[model samples]
Target: MTIFEATGAAGEQNIWGIVLPFVLMFAVFYFLLIRPQQKKSKQRTAMLNQIKKGDKITTIGGLHGTVVELTDDTVVIRVNDTTKMTFERSAVNTIVSSAPAVAADK
Candidate 1:
């Protein structure tokens, strides 16, 4: 009778042992993968909202230009003295330099 009861208790503990590892794995994934991605997305949205005219920006496709105009969905980028291209706001990867950086550095 003692041996049978001990075996049943051990099986109950084994159920928790299996579930604990899956719960820990999910926690690790949330911290390592999901959390950082959410943070980066928020930061990118903030950057896009803060964009203004004359900011030097680079696109995901490697186009670098100065922002000339901003609209709700598009930005006009002057790539050269006389050439300009309009790109979607989401196409901008980062602002390479703000107006302050241009004036203060040189």
Candidate 2:
């Protein structure tokens, strides 16, 4: 083949070699990091949505209490009989024990 044709073929291969690594890296990142993070975030959102009065929970900052009231963006926790504290809904970390399910009258 002519020198010009040879160089053109090598140039095409060179472009693919550079681009293939980037494409593969993006795929790896998506599977290993992005996907799991998104899944965990959804689970956390679901857990937060399920919060209700009387459920025991802990906050991200380590406070533990029973849920007393809930609002769109806040929760009032009863720390003790005479002590209650309000926290942002997003501050909740985990539900310690789910509240008992209410039964319907037969």
Candidate 3:
């Protein structure tokens, strides 16, 4: 085959090779980064909404406590005997235990 014809064929292949890598990168980012992040956010929101008094929880800052009072946008958590702290509902990280936790000293 002529050199001109060979060059033309290679040019077309190069364009697709360049584009394919970018497409694959985007797919990887979506599945590995974006999709899992979205799922985690949804789960966190659902957990916050389901919180109730006496449920044991931990804050995003790692403080462990029990839910004492809940409001529209905030929660009152008893961190220890006579130690209560208020935090935004969104600040709760996870439910340490789903069962109602009774203070042993009570």
Q: Specify the highest-lDDT model's number.
A: 2
TM-score, cand. 2: 0.90
Q: What's the CA error at residue 34 for candidate 1, in Å? A: 0.9
Predicted candidate 3 versus true structure: per-residue lDDT over 16-54, tens digit per residue: 999999999999999999999999989888888999998
Each prediction's whole-model lDDT (CA): 0.95, 0.98, 0.93
Q: TM-score for each prediction?
A: 0.81, 0.90, 0.72
Candidate ranking under TM-score, highest first, comes to 2, 1, 3
Residue 13 miss distance in model 2 (angstroms): 0.6
lDDT of 2: 0.98
Cα error, candidate 1, residue 17 (Å): 1.2
lDDT tens string, model 1, 1-106?
Answer: 6999999999999999999999999999999999999999999999999899989999999999999999999999999999999999999999998875445565
Deviation in angstroms for 14 in model 2? 0.7
Which stretch of 10 consecutive residues in model 2 shows the poorest summed lDDT? 96-105
